[model samples]
Target chain A: MKFGFLMREIGQGLSRNVSMIVSIILVTFLSLTFVGTAGLLQAQIGQMKTYWYDKAQVAIYLCTDTSPADACPQGEASSDVKATVEAALKDAALTPFVERYYFEDHQAAYDKFQEQFADNAVAKYVKKEQLNETYWVKVKDPNKSAVIVESFTGVAGVEEVRDQRSYLDQIFSILNAASIAAVGIAAIMLASAVLLISTTIRLSAFSRRREIGIMRLVGASNFYIQLPFILEGVVAATIGSVLASGAVVAIVVFFVQGYLAQRLPLTSFVGVDDALLLMPLIIGSGVVLAAIASGFAIRRYLKI
Target chain B: MISFSNVTKQHKGAPKPALDAVSLEIERGDFVFLVGASGSGKSTLLRLMLREEIASRGDLFVLGQNLVTIPSRKVPALRRKMGVVFQDFRLLPNKTVFQNVAFSLEVIGKSSAYIADAVPEVLRLVGLEEKADRLPNELSGGEQQRVALARAIVNKPDLLLADEPTGNLDPATSAGIVSLLEKINQNGTTIVMATHDVGIVDRLKRRVIELRGGVIVRDDKKSGYETALPITDQVPISSDTEPEQGNEPEQANEPEQGNEPESRISSTDQAEEQE
Candidate 1:
């Protein structure tokens, strides 16, 4: 029941099995780091969903005077054909899918293209008459862009229908796979951490069993006998979790926010606040995991 | 004070019960010896009193708490009332004699000041004050047992239960240990010691409870036997008041029952603080 005595015993336990404790710490650290990384990756995915998905449009290009597509069979879309396509966008069957629609004239498209390719040698040969007009459509659901694309793909005067969600799907799938891999690695490491904590507790308890037997014979309570051993596992796991939290914060701040943010200004990365928020979860898991491991270990290895 | 009412402790696979329907009453300040052969249930009786094992079929009252009904969680607090010494001199190998004695006080939540004052006093009581700093391994078997005794009685327990306390020592050393038990008994602490040391039993002439084949073969107010002899037919279980066939002496020593060690614990704690 003396705090000083229990603390000294815990210190002795850790010192006697330094290598085993270190391994426990390292395993917990690695597992929690992966957990934090997976968390941050999920956060980034959420942020990208808001940032890129909002900007993801379904672009419907209208045929121009010099258009070669079969849908533009008149060499250019007639004003009547353009009017018909515009009417179809507002038709009751397709109207529910479209959030808003904007038509870019041939001249506006020509000017934007010319400005984007201002330094290109082929720019002078590209005339306003050759540019295609476009109806840039924003859908209520980015995932449902296929519905809008199918509705307008073969319409007269429409050259092509491109859904930006397709590009997002490819990018998100890759990110999702990477996140899953991080979680997979984290799961394995977490299991190893639990096993290591249990082993550390068992070895420490076994080594100090003579003292434990004396304590029991001398009328020490069960909790008094078990505390020092449990504290050993908790101490190692806490240090491991702290290290993992540090690594997580470093990755979020230095790598994700600083380096990646600078390198990819268009992409949004998880910030330090998000990383700090995930810390409680990582640290909590470390504590709870160690507590459970030590609980079982003590139950198995100690008569008390 | 301890009382066993028809206590029967039967092991699962053993041929017979370790203790069979035997009643016993031990008073405070009584120096009693539990004598039997290798498997006569002496150790089992001590363990039953300590609440390490419960009575299989009957009630046992030790230090006024019913051993059968007491909650298992409260066993440690109950054990704190009495001291137990083992054959192996179960001392901490790494701790010096002083620290080893202090360790018991430290565990029961005694303050540092109390531990510092009480540990040396206990060592002095056991005449090991000079060897207070020596580790257990450095001391002889008798000295180590003394240190163990010091640790057990440092808290001023109401009773002491020793199972083969002198088993590891020589005859001379065993005599010294028996004298220590008698001294503690004279100081009003009851001592229940189980041993096969016939010489010490004959010399002490204290109350002897002889067990044979899991039954109390003899219980005399004052008894001395030269060797373990089977005499089951001479003494019967129904003869609680009747005397057995022995050169038994008429005695007039009876200890008052119901001395609560919990009160003594608080007083000792306060005494440590006051000093």
Candidate 2:
């Protein structure tokens, strides 16, 4: 049989069964949307991880003259103590873990505090002599910041050790939860798409039963009888995929880019370019899904 | 050629066999009529020949293929050598006459070039060349039947089985359909028609096998056929001058000697004598 003839029959079958075709398209579109959205969310989470992890540093502040008794055993950390803390960070044993380290003396600390709190009353009270000196350490692996923080927590001159990853971990936990939920929804919707496409093909076959019977009498092969229905399913899925990709791109650009980008540029959400990058994946999934669903339906219902 | 040796068919959940130990043979180029009342297994016998229903017991062969042992996958290939017509004329509603006829060729993977030549030739054979573009709905009952006939014979099947081909047509139209079938048979295609149209059967004067109560009680082949009016006409011929009178008296005298029941004897005896 000519492939063109098979395709024409598939086109006719789809057109005649318009309601079934639409149902298949809608189910496929919804399923692929959830799938594509999950992918975009994962990409966004990855972007955020890279952005926050790269800048995440451990901030160790030395006790200052204004530090509470809990913070410091005597008065402010002396120049000798601060110098000792800076030298300890440069030790050869920790060299591989630490990328680089910077020290802020009392004057520099005071100036940084004034810059951060220009409108606060605390800025007037904080003089150069009363400020705390600190060493900020950038590590090669932000994920292992806890090891470095523990190393410095009880060191001679360190007043406090903090790893920024702990704070970001809470946000990533929420993103991970959301990603799991998205995957679950996508799986359910994909199953629905398969079922709907199968039912649609079944109904199409039912309506064409007479034609099929006649074809069988004329020595038509089973494959020839089923080709049109399989093609119908694939076409519906392909259209659904195209529509879903368009919707995903529109959502990413108009919503993520236009609104979220302006409001929280620092969050580093996925843009249209990133969602569009997954177009091939989305379309591939759609075609495979349609073909599989139709193949199974044809096998079960059309026995030649 | 078709042959049945003690073929038996028992449908699912049925108390009795649809066909019971039926043994018959139809030669090539012979136009045979299978006559029976409803539930007498006329349709069942036809279905068996098409392999739509397999014999429950015994051997059945068509075109030298053992239908009883043939696999379902190869049934279509076997059917290509046969043309079957149904009472309902199962044409695809969406297809035009040309497409419907062309479909037979299409299914067999005939090239477009052959389809173009063959479809029109078959349409012309059925005398429906002008109605090629018309859908089944647009054609009259007789025209639709002709389209179906065209489709059946388009591939030039070796045998034609028509089950009630003119069941829904008028008497005049029924005769015309039978003549068409006869014409095809004359051209070397064997025809087996199952009909309740006694008028056409009697008029054709071909081989007639009368079935009653799921058995072939009679088989006949002759010319100068006796035409029976339709049941609705209510014009019963007197039994004294009936063509079957001679056989009826002899069968009546020895009713207990034959396996056939007395109620089925007269028709079967006349049919047997014709054969």
Candidate 3:
């Protein structure tokens, strides 16, 4: 048969089973919505990981004049000790891992502490004489910061060394778990959608058994008879995916950007622009899901 | 041309065979009528010829294809060489008369140029050129049957197997259908009609094969009416030269006396017997 004839038949078949088509569309839309949501969450989590980890720094505190430990028993680090610590940081062995280092004296630390706690009662206790000088070091790899921290710990005149990634690591563990759960739910819903589509197509075929029989007797090839039904399923699924992507975009814009961006500005969650960036991925996934579901469904039920 | 040797068909779950150890041959260009009461396997015989049902034990050949062993995938190619008509007229309700007729040619991948020319020609042959645009529901019973006939013969199949094509029509309409079938046969398309319409059989005076309980009880080339009795008398007369009423039941029952009817036989029967 001609391609035009096949298309016309597919069009007529879809129109004739309009109610079934609509049902398929609704099922596919809801399923793909979950799938898209899971995808966007994963992307957002990755983005947050990149943003927080890249700027993370290791803070090394130097003993001040009131310190109790022998490392700084004189209650202040001598100029020679400070020079030794700075020279050790700049050694050729550590140069590749260390990006840059900046030193803060007691007066600068006291001012920064007071500025951070300006509204709190702690601001009174954070006096100029009690604050310790510190060195803030940036590293090339946040994941490898433990090695550098261990090297700096217990060094002469070094009171403490801590990487800021521990807090971010906890948050990322939760996000990773949630992403896995979302993917699991999406997979289950996807299977259900495929089964529902296959059943719908089977029912459509059963309803038209007489027509199929006639076509068979008339020497129609197996492909010729099956193409229209398969195309019908695919068309319904494509429409559903498009609807789902639109829903995702709308939800991201109205809820995530407009509401959450204003309400929780500090968390650095998904922005409307980021969601828009996922448009190609969302649409591509939808098409692939629909095509696979429709292809397998036709193969199972419409075999000649 | 068709031939069957010791053909027997036993349907699944049935106690008896549908066709029991029967042998028959139909020559090319001959119009034959298969007549039997319901449950006597007339339809089964027609189906066997069409390869719709395979024989349980036999060698059957239609148009030189060994039907018992032909693969299912090749059935369509074999069916394309023959036309079939059904009692229900099996016309697609949504298709126009023109499309219905054109569908036959479409299956064989005929070019649009050929279809455009061939479809109208076939419709005109069936005298339905004016009703080309109308759907099957818009046509009457007889007209629908004619459309089916147009579809069946459009490809000029080698044989036509019609199973009760006129069973639902009125007597006059039925006669018209029989005449159309005859006209097609005269133009050299072999026809095998399965019907219980005795009036048509007696009136048309064609070769008739009568079946009873899955056996060919009577095969006759010449049968004349015993006008002294009612027209319902069902008897087999083998000789065209013999008078209609003089043959006794005892003589008709003689077994294995194949030499008695040599003079009345045709050259076709002689050739068949030689084979």
> What lDDT tens digits, residue by residue, belong to model 2 across residues A1-304?
7866877788789888998899888888888888888888889889989999999999897886666777677667777877677677788878888999898787888888899999999888867877667788999998778777987887655678888877888898888888889889989989988999999999998988888899887768777788888989999999999998988898898899989999986677887789879888999999998999999998899774
| Model 2 chain A weakest lDDT span, ten residues long | A64-73
- For candidate 1, the per-residue lDDT at B27 reads 86
- B13, model 2: CA deviation in Å? 2.9
Q: iRMSD per model? A: 1.3, 1.5, 2.5
Q: Which regions of candidate 3 fall more than 4 Å away from where they truly are? A: A59-96, A101-109, A126-135, A149-162, A252-304, B1-32, B35-78, B103-114, B201-275
Q: What lDDT score is found at residue B21 in candidate 1?
A: 90
Question: Of the pair 1 and 3, which is ahead by TM-score?
Answer: 1
Q: Any residue pairs clashing in model 3, and if so which?
A: A65-A75
lDDT of each: 0.83, 0.80, 0.76
Assess every candidate by TM-score.
0.84, 0.79, 0.74
lDDT of 3 by residue, A1-304 (tens): 6766667777877887888889878877877777777777777788888899888998888877777766666567677778977887899977788999999998898888888888999898767777778888899888888877998788767777889887788887887788777678767877777777777777777777666665665556667677777778888888888888888888788887788778988767776676666666666765676667666766676543
RMSD in Å for model 2: 7.8
Cα miss at B136, model 2 (Å)? 3.5
> In model 1, where do residues sit more than 4 Å from their true spots?
A61-81, A84-99, A105-133, A139-162, B227-230, B235-275
Global CA lDDT of candidate 3, please? 0.76
Predicted complex 3: DockQ: 0.23
lDDT agreement of model 1 with the native: 0.83
